[model samples]
Target: MSTTTSTTTRSPDAIRGRRLGVLLVLCGAIFLEGIDVAMLNVALPSVRADLGLETGVLQWVMSAYVLGYGGFMLLGGRAADLFGRRRMFVGWLTVFLVFSGLGGLATEGWQLIAARFVTGVAAAFMTPAGLSIITTGFEEGPQRDKALLVYSGTAAGGFSIGLVAGGLLASAGWRWVFFAPVGLAALILLGALALVPKEPARPGRSGQKLDLAGGLLVTSAVILLVLGVERAAHAGAAWTAATVGAGLLLLAVFAAVERRAAEPLVRLGILRSGPLVRSGGAGLLFSGGFFGFQFLVVLYLQELRGWSTLETSFAMLVIGIDAVLSPTVVPKLVARFGNGRLIFGGLLVAALAYGLFLPLGADWSYLVMLPGLILLGLAFALVYGPLTIVATEGVAESEQGLAGGLLYTGFQFGAALGLSSVTAVAAAYADPLEGYRAALLVPFAAVLAAAALSLPGLRRRAEQPDAEALPGAGAGAGTEGGTPAGAAAGLEPARG
Candidate 1:
C-alpha cells in the first residue's frame, strides 16, 4: 500500500512550505508524547500521597502504560499500513487527548491507571503513524535527513524540558501535570487537521486484510516479555523465570505463524537487511544504556544525596543540550562522516561518560559530574537522529510503519531490561554506595557493546566505492541495486 501524497500544481516553494508545516505538526505530536510521560513520572509521588495507594499499586501507574505501549506497538504500526496513516494518527491523537484529561480528573488510583494505559496505547498508534508519515512524505535524501533530525531533536527537548515543567506543575498540583498535555494535544490535533496531507488512495488497499492471528500472537508475546522484565526486580525469581520463558515460547510460535500466514503482519525478510538490523540493535543498546544511567542518577541524587527533585532536574538539564545540537551540529557531521561512524563515535563517548562517573562519592559536587552530563548530551545528539535515518532508509513504503514498530520495540524492551537488571544488582548489595557503583557498570557495559555492534557497519562503509559511500546516496540515488535484498524483489521506492 502506498502512503504518497497526491501531487498538485502548486509552486515548488509552496509545496516546501506545506511540507514544513506538516513536519512541524508531526513533531509537535511527538513532543507531546515525550513530555506527557516525563510529566507523569514527576507527579507520581504526589499521586501516591493523594490517593493513599500502596507502593505496588503506585508502581502499576507507570507499568500499566509501559505494558500497553510495548505490547500493542507492533500491531499499531502495521495497522497504519493496512488502514491509513493519517486516519490512525488523527483518531489516536483524539483518544490520547480525551484520556489524558480523564487522567487529570481521576479520583481513584485505578481510574488514573486505566486512563494512563489507554493513553499509552493511543501513543503506540500515534507515534509510528507520525514517523511513517514523515518517512513517506519527504523524499529520502538530505531533505528527509534534516526533517528527521529536527523531529528527533524536538522529542528529546520535550522530555528534557518536561522535567522542569513537571516539577513546577506538580508544585501547583499533580493534576496540572495531566492537564498540561491536554492543552498541548488539543493544539497539536488542530494543527494536524489543518496541515497533514491526505493519504493518496492505493489500488488494492481497500480489499487488503490484516493478519489478525499473527497480530494477536505477536502482541501477546511482546506484552508477556515486557511484563516479565518489568516484574523481575519486584517479583519472585520463580515467577519471573516462568513469565519470561513463556514469552519466549510464544515468540517462537509467533515466528512460526508468520512464516505460514498468507499475509503476515510483519515481513520477515526486512529483518535480513544488514543496516536495518544493525540500527535496531544499536537503538536497543543505546536506549538501554541511556535510560539505565538516568535511572541510577536519579536514585543517587535523591535517595543517596538528599537532593530535592527540582535540584536534580536542574542538574540533569544539561543532557537536554542534545535538543539544540541534533538539528544543527549533527547534520554537518553526518554529511562528513556518514551515519555509521557518527553512531560508533556516539556510543564510545557515551561509554566514556559512564566510566567517568563510575566513582560514587557521597559528597561529590555537581561540578564533578558536569563534564559527563555534557558528553552524554553530545553523544545523544550524535546517535539518535543517525540511528533513526539508518533504520528506515531503505525499507519499502508499505512497511515503513512496521520498520518503525520494530525499532521502537527494541528500544522499549532494552529499556525494560536495563532498568530491571540494574535494579536487581543494586538490591543485591548491603552497602548502598557499593550497590550504586556496581549498578553503574550496567550502562557502561551496555554502551561498550553498542559501540562494538556499530564497528562492522563502519568497516563495510569504508570498503564501499566512494560514489556508493556518499552520504544520503543509499536513500535516493536510485532503486537499481541500492535497495535491500528483500525490498528489491517487489517493493517500490516511496513516492514524494
Candidate 2:
C-alpha cells in the first residue's frame, strides 16, 4: 500500500510560470471573441460598397450577429456547465473561424449576413464557455483575480487593435480584417488544445436540453426591442407602442419559463441578493449611459465635425484607453473607498462627463472632448473591478459561473437597450445637442436608482440579524469548493 505524500515545498516560480501560460491562453481566446464583436462594424461600410448592397440590406449584417449573441448568452453559460468546457471551446472556435472565412469569400450581402449570424451563434458558445475555462482552471482568490484582469486587459487591447485594423483593412479592403481574425483564431485554437485542461464530466450532465422555447422567446423579444428602437425615428407612435408591448410580453414569458425550469437559464433567486440586485440594475443603467455617450459623440465627430473614419478612430482611442485602463485602477480604489462608495462616486463622475458633452456643436475642437473623456475614463475605472467584485463577491463558488454570466448579461442587454434609448431620445427631439443632452440624463437617473438599491444593506431587517448574515450577501459569494459562498448559499444543490 502506497500513501501519497503532499508536498508544499514546490517552487513559487514554477507555479507562477504555469499560471502565466494559462492566462495568455485565456486572454487570447477572450480577445478574439470581443474583437469579433466590434470588428465587423468597422468594416460594415466597406462591406456594403463591395457587396453592391442596398442600404436596407446592411442592417442584417450587424443585427444577425447581435441577435445570435444576446439570444444565446443565458443558454451558453448553462451549456458550459453541462458539456465539457474544453470540448465546447474547441467546437465553437472551429465554427467561428469557418464563418469568418465564409464572410471573407462572400460576394453578396445575404451571404455575409448569414455568415455573421452563424459566427454569433458560434461566439455565444465561445465567449461564456471561454469564461468557464477561466473559472475551472484558476483556483479562486488572487490567481483568479490576476487572470481575469488579464482577460479584461486583453479585451480592451483587442478593441484598440480592432480599430487600427478596421482602418487599415478598410483601406486595404475588408477581407483582410476577416482573414486576420481567422489566422488569430487558428493560433488560439492550437494553443487551447494543448494548454486548456480537460474539464471533468458534469455532475448531472444531460448534455443541455436548452429551454428552446425560452431561448426563442427571449431572442424574438430582443430583436423586436432593437428593431423598435431603431425604427423609432420612422415608426409612428402607435406602431412603436405595439412593438414595445409585444416585446415586453415575450420577455415576461421568457422570465416565467426561467423561473420554473428544472434547469432554468437564469436562476431568478440569484437576483434576490441586495448586492447582486444593485449591481445588476446599476450595470444596466451605467452601460446604457456609457453607450449613449459613445453613440452621440461618434455622430458629432463624423457628421458635424467632418472627421474621416480614420481620424475619428484615432480620437476614439481616448475612450478605449480608459476602458482598458480601469481594471488596473479598481483594486486600489476598492482598497481606499470600499465598493459602494466607488460605485456611487463613479456614477457621479460619469454623469458629469455626459454633462460636459451637452454644450458641444459643429464648432467643437478635439481639445474640447478631452476633459469629458478623462472624466468618463475615470468613472469607467471606478466601475470595472468594484462592480465585478460586487457581482461575484456574494456569489457561491458553485454559482460563480452563473454570477459571472448574469453580471455580464446585464451589461450586454443594458448596452443594447441603453444605446437604443439614446437614439430614440435624439430622434424624438431632432435637435442633436438636445437629444444627446437627454440621453445623458439616463445615466444620471440610473446612478440614483443604484444608490437607493444599495442603501438597504446599511439597514437591518427586523428578523434577519446583521447585514452580513443576509443570504447572497457579499461575504457569502465565491466560497467553498471553489464556489462563491454568498450566491450559492441558498442555491438549490448542484444541478445533477
**Residue range 1-496, candidate 1, lDDT tens digits:** 2323353333221225667788889989989988988878777888999999899999889988888888889999999878878889999999999999999999988999999899989988998888888777765666678888889999999988888888889889999998999998999999988877677566656788999998888888998999999989999999999999999998899999988987889867766667777888988888888888898998899899998777878888899999999888888888778888999999999999999989978889999999999999999999999988888876666777887888888888888888888889899999888998999999999999998888876864433313322322454432323443113322222233
Q: lDDT for each of the candidates?
A: 0.83, 0.66
Per residue, candidate 2 scores C-alpha lDDT tens digits across 38-94 of 567667778888888776688768767766666566666666655556677788889
Worst 10 residues of 1 by lDDT: 485-494
Candidate 1: segments with Cα more than 4 A from true spot: 1-15, 460-496
Winner by TM-score: 1
Backbone atom clashes (below 3 Å) for every candidate:
0, 24
Off by over 4 Å in 2: 1-15, 202-209, 429-496
lDDT of 1: 0.83
